[model samples]
Target: MKLTLRTVGVFTLCLLLTACSLPRGAGIEQEITAGANDADADFAMYPVTRDFLPTLAEWPVVGEPELNWITASAGARTQIINPGDVVAITIWDSNDNSLLAAPGQRAVNLEEMRVAANGTIFMPYIGDTRISGLTPQAARARLQSELEAIVPSAQVQLAMAAGMHSSVDLVGGVNAPGTYPMPDQSYSVLSLISQGGGVSGALRNPQIRLMRHGQLYGTSIARLYSEPHLDTRLVGGDRVIVEEDRRYFLSLGAAGIQDQHAFPQDVVTALDAMSIIGGVSSSRADPEGILILREYPASALRTGQRGPRQERVVFTLDLTTSDGLFSARNFRIQSGDLVLATESPVSSVQTVFSLFGSAFGLVNAVTN
Candidate 1:
């Protein structure tokens, strides 16, 4: 028993000493100031800082793709009369001499007159009157003036009969995806999404896309909710799309949870991201070895940089200090980031000693 105790004690002492000189895992710390001797480790290493965090956040988040817009007007174009639209014009003569009257009819029914390509609808006595750019009320006034020459006391009433051309499309990832008509010319983007029973899954992170005239604009649902003004009005023939955000980052190594996690919010800071994934494993992780691996466009690093630029960049944080804590809080976590919590050398040394101590205890018991 004394021999076993001595062997275990000496083995543990040696491991504790080796802990100081133990090797570290892959990170920016090693190569940040490395000489030309290190060739394989090629990447720009950035230490987390108050000023640098904002620059990292400046890294652009992707927007939706482009599409064609029928209403090319800025800031959610208002609906207007278009060709192929159907309008109903009713004509009433103040007296029995209504120019629009049929045999024994008291009024003339110009039902469902399709607007011709020339942007006008035909009226009974007044041939073709342009109404494509005019509202229903405006069109009525236009017809009344034209017929005043023939039927000086003619009253004209106009209203749209067909709505197939003036509607918003609810497409992809919506609970009730279909075509819904605009309530008025001022129907908004949010109102259209709400009409489809809201978005699927968490409304916070779902992508919202607005496509018009081959031009595409989009943002996260959370962003749209935060900035109410960004939820611009919708026009006829505009398509509003709500879809799931597929952006995610991987947590590996000594993290408490090793998995791929999609960001819950539109903007996720590094500190919050770490907490969401259960943080680093207290026993196995090196607090000073927290590393974030990212890829940047080669052109981004080429500007104002002295050395040859590389696409792969490594950002290291030493959470053991107060400066790092604040820096991490402000640092933004980009999509597709690989967050790695490296193993501590002390823990590795402790593991070896633990196994040896167990073997020694077993041998001592057997000998007895």
Candidate 2:
């Protein structure tokens, strides 16, 4: 009996000695950050707190494309003739010897007179008449005055059909994507989207992109919906594309759900990301060791207050403290960040204790 007890004690001591080598779902907080303090460490570590928030904000934004958006501007509601527009004209002359209309004909119909690149259309006797920038009503009056010189009783009627140069293209992420003719100068991004059909329901956090004369502009649909003042007017020959938000982040280790998650909205705080990732595993994760791993471009590293000290950075968060909780709520998660929920140190100790308890129970049974 004494020998058996000694054997069990020796076996128990062996486990405690090798406990550090025990298999674990994730690395303990200290294990991951062991070499972080070394002078030649490759990464920089920062504790996320209220005081650090301001400094972090000054760092350059990474992972997402930087884009600019145009503000909305008011424009005329009437359609103006463009260079590619097609105009139709009708002339009414009561004179029997009219230059425009034949003897028996009281009216002359001129169809499909396309506006030229120089904003002018050729008439039989009037030569090239500039009408590109004029409205249909104004162009008709101008043409009538010009025709009245040849036929004193002449009156002109004009109609315009928008051409390729006077239309905007709805590229994608819409129900009906195609070229839509701009009815007037007041045609807006929202109006164009409505004409093509609203953004696709399947798209997750749809984004708006405008391509105008080689320049690109971008924004999210949510913002445009909330701020009416940002619904900028669309110009002719512009190409607008609506697409799903491509920004995403990843989760690993003791997190509840370890996988890639798309950004739910424009901005995602650390608290928001934790919720998106289903929070950490309550049984295994250390609440004080939530770490965010991010890698910035080499150019983002600088010796100033406005950039990161290293290309690779690890931001630590302690959900166990009130300050940490509040800070995490404001810590914005950038695109491509990795949310790592490290394992608790006591978890492995508890595991070893469980094995020891089993061995002690077996010894009691043998004695009984």
Candidate 3:
């Protein structure tokens, strides 16, 4: 019996000695954070809590480019004549002999008269008349006033059709993307999108980009929906494009699903990211050691409280505490971030004990 006990003890001791070499799916919490305590560590570590939320909030927005959005503005309700527009004019003269019409003819039809670059159209008896910025009705009235000097009884009727300068282009991510003519000055981005059959449903967090006069403006569809004031009016020659959001973050270590997750909404909180990754592995993850790793630009490491202490930062979250849980709900996750669920130290200990049990059983079998 003493010999058997001695053999079992020796086997267990040997297993204990080699326990540090045990294979693990992820590093233990302490092992990953051990270097953080060194004076000259390469990265700076921060504990995410309610008290730290303010400091994190003050940091510069990273990951995505800062894009500006145009606000909605009121415009004329009627279509205005532009340089490329084609105008058709008709003159009705009741006089015996009219300069615009023949002696027997009571009316004259002037068709396919295109507006020139100088915002003018040539007319018989009258010189170049500027009507580019005038509404269709206003331009007709102006033409009538000009013709009255030559023929007092002449009544002018005008019709204008939109040209390339009076239309907007819906580039992509819509059911029907093409050049849509602006029926009136009130035509807006949302109006154009609705005419194009709305944004595609297959897109994940779609983004709207407007290119006008060599400048580009961008915003998300969700923002345009939530804030009606942001559905900006579209100008002629503007090109609008709808595309899927390309921002994503990575999940590794003891997480439930190790994969890259796209931002489902405009702002993804840390808690939202955790849900996106399908939560951590319950068996191996430490509830108090969720770490988020991010790298900031070198310029973001300026000497101030508004910036990060180092270019490489490790943000720690303790889901075991209520404060940590609530803070994570408000903490924002930037693009290209890595969320790591550190393995529990206790899990490695459990594995060692299981191995020891198997070794002791082997020793008993040999002794028997």
Candidate 4:
């Protein structure tokens, strides 16, 4: 039968459409199921418990009451008052004639006195006197009374001269991690981080933990940034640990990009993460079918003999759909998520042709 130009064009179009519409094999479906099963198996290898889910739920929302530094029994501020502390005492209306005369003059110029290990300090003719446990003001008054007998109308003033009377240690993921001295005795956790040169550049959603007496008092980072009230005050010996950003997700298979990436804090969406690895490789990618394997914390799963349980959800999206849905690509990805892209038969066929062409070219070159 003779075919007209119009008929030939129509036939070709039909052929192309039919080829595109070819039914996918049960093998492909099985592969997807098997892939999911394998992923779950891999996940099952680790211990999974539901303990973490509840903990995540209990976490404070965007707005909540700020925690108090003093009330927080976990990271309480502890003051280590010890001997050998240098104390400054100011005496007015009292000449040093007596002090100079006794104890063989003792160098004459004494601005501060060091407490001996015995918890006593010798003041000229006053002899050994215990002054431990006395606040600077109280100690001054006691010294005045003792000196009054030798020097009439002697006024005394006492204050802490050295050592950490009030300070906090800033450690972990910060530019300068170390102990910072708090002279004013009143500074918030945020201030201490600033003093330690701020958070490290590589860390995202940097975690700040308050540890008091070797126990976890409170943890804040992302939540604290949202609510300023949560950044509680810093106390002496209070440990403020800022942990680095270690959470991440994996992307493998037929994706345009195949690699692992450090999870971003707030701004990272599911789509944004895909873009980081170079998006789906169009040549081998099935734009209609994509898979995401989200791995919740082991604590979020059910406890079993082998390990913790994992919950897997599969979703498919057509790229040809409205652009709005594509924007969902920005949906945030959780830690341990694995993104997989499948290959379309058409793309596979194209790859085979390309390989054949390359092989033919090599043979011709050799023969030539």
Candidate 5:
């Protein structure tokens, strides 16, 4: 029994010696050390302070333009027409043998005419009459006046046919993506998406991007639905694209679950993100040592910023304190950020003693 006890003591001593001999990685102090070699320092470590909170808050806001779907859908349809449109004319002549009327015919069907480059069309009596920019009703009134003298008591009816000139495209991530024509100018963004069969349910975090007049604008469909005004109006030559959102952040160290998670909404606070991964491990996490690793552009750093003049940045917080808890509630989490909850020092000591207890118990069992 005495020899077995001595053996267990020797085994425990060896574990302590081995643990102390391992090399330690650089800490927050090394990152903030001034006059240090840039080759040795990889990033800047910042303590969570009231002054530094604004920097993190600015990261998640990308400044998006708001588009009102209600205003876009409520407007009266425009009467302006464009090229490549077909027009049909009908005339009721009182007598036959006229240039536009046939023999013994009370009504004459005029040949369909396509508008030319000058937005004009030719007729029997009227020469080069422009009708491209006018509506069917307006064009009929204008043309009737031109033929009143030549064909007395002649009534005119006009119909304009729509072409592919007024269409919006639905591209990618949709169940039935295609070009949908807007015969009526009251087509809203949601109306176009509904026609394209809407976004696919298989896609995670689908985004709706609109390209209009050579400029690209976009937002999440979930967001667009939440805010009715964001649905906007879709005009001709507008391209709507639906795709999966790729923005994400990583959780590491003593977190309850270590994995990469995508942003669920347009804005997410640091406190909200901790709730997302089930919070930190209760037994192993050090509540006072919550650290957020991030990288920012050097150009974005303010003149009086307390960090290095480089892009790499780190932010540390102590959740045990009231200040940290409130600041974290307001601090925003940006994409590609790394949220780490450090392991408690007491847990490390407890683990070492646990191994010693196991060794001693095994030796006693063998001796008995």
Candidate 6:
């Protein structure tokens, strides 16, 4: 092919267009903005309708005392009993002269016994007995009846010497992060978090989740703490993970201000995010060139990795439209998201000034 001015001009134009394209960081901003606008419009057109609505006139701001009392009392306690729990059993006889006249009374210490696969325990005098589903009091009654058959008029007592002990693991954004012993085992999620010394100062509403066999179990910390009944018991093999809060976006480049800001956990409108970045700088920020770029985990882009699959969806955002720009906040920020702001065309003025300074330096060097 023969080279010509027309072809050269076209090639130059293409290069200029490519250069004008936003940088990698700016792509994330555009994606977020677009997503926000789309979500906002969807929400506006179809305002959400719920099953019940509270009336301010009827309900007091502080709530009713009776209602509050009911709510507090309604919170049920959860018992987390497991195998390998150290339990003490006491036996007494009123008419049996042999047991009553014995010089010394000895207490049998059955240090925590592992729950057998069949869920039965073999005690000293009692043959294979099922105590898995029975409460401490019930188990004692059963033991007394069985022993009375052998020796009439026998009294029995059964109690847990020490509460159940289970290993609960804690990590991330905590002062003291490690496995904790949940002994007086109750279903209080907050109790477990307190043992771990709570979340770090930088994180807000830290996500404390309970997992078993790689599956999420139980509700969030907020819900579990507020509603005690929801604070499900921690099982023997259950794992508790405390993760750092990562639900915020970073706005950089030519925006009015450049900084990382947090978004609401539930739902954030695009207008909310724009306000956080100081509402865009008119002098240095490009109104037409706003972009949003999202990076995906490399493993996510690949096929068939072991464990859970990661979704790496990247999109764009244009702030030119009044409604579209305001919708940016509606797009939620996923963990590890990077948001960037693009500079206006006038930013090149600084480069020109730098070039002039370089030329002046060269002249001085040549003269010297």
RMSD of each: 5.0, 1.5, 2.2, 9.6, 4.6, 12.3
C-alpha lDDT (0 to 100) for residue 3 of candidate 4:
46
Q: Local error of candidate 3 at 23, Å?
A: 2.3
Q: Write the per-residue lDDT of candidate 4 for residues 120-159, one digit (tens) a residue.
A: 7787668887876565656777888988888775566666
True-structure RMSD for candidate 1: 5.0
Q: Clashing residue pairs, candidate 5?
A: none
Order the candidates by TM-score, highest first.
2, 3, 1, 5, 4, 6
lDDT of 6 by residue, 1-368 (tens): 34555755575555456545535333323334444435333211111112111111121211111111111122224223345544566556555353433545433345555545465667656677776655566777777788777766667676653223345666666788776655534534566677778767676655666666666643335555677766555655566666644466767776656776664442343455566678776656666555444444344332433211223333234577654554454444443344446655565454445555665565456546
Candidate 3 lDDT, tens digit per residue, 157-250? 9987788789999988999999999999889999999999999999999999999999999999999999999999988899999999989999
List lDDT for all candidates, in order: 0.72, 0.90, 0.90, 0.58, 0.72, 0.51
Candidates 2 and 6 compared: the better one by TM-score is 2
Q: What TM-score do all the candidates reach, one by one?
A: 0.80, 0.96, 0.92, 0.58, 0.78, 0.57
**Poorly placed runs, candidate 3 (over 4 Å):** 1-6, 93-96, 102-109
lDDT score for candidate 3 against the true structure: 0.90
The window of 10 residues in a row where model 5 has the poorest summed lDDT is 23-32
Taking the tens digit of each residue's C-alpha lDDT, what string does model 5 give over 9-46?
78888877765543322222222334334566666566
User: Candidate 5 clash total?
Assistant: 0
Arrange candidates by lDDT, descending: 2, 3, 1, 5, 4, 6
Highest TM-score: give the candidate number.
2
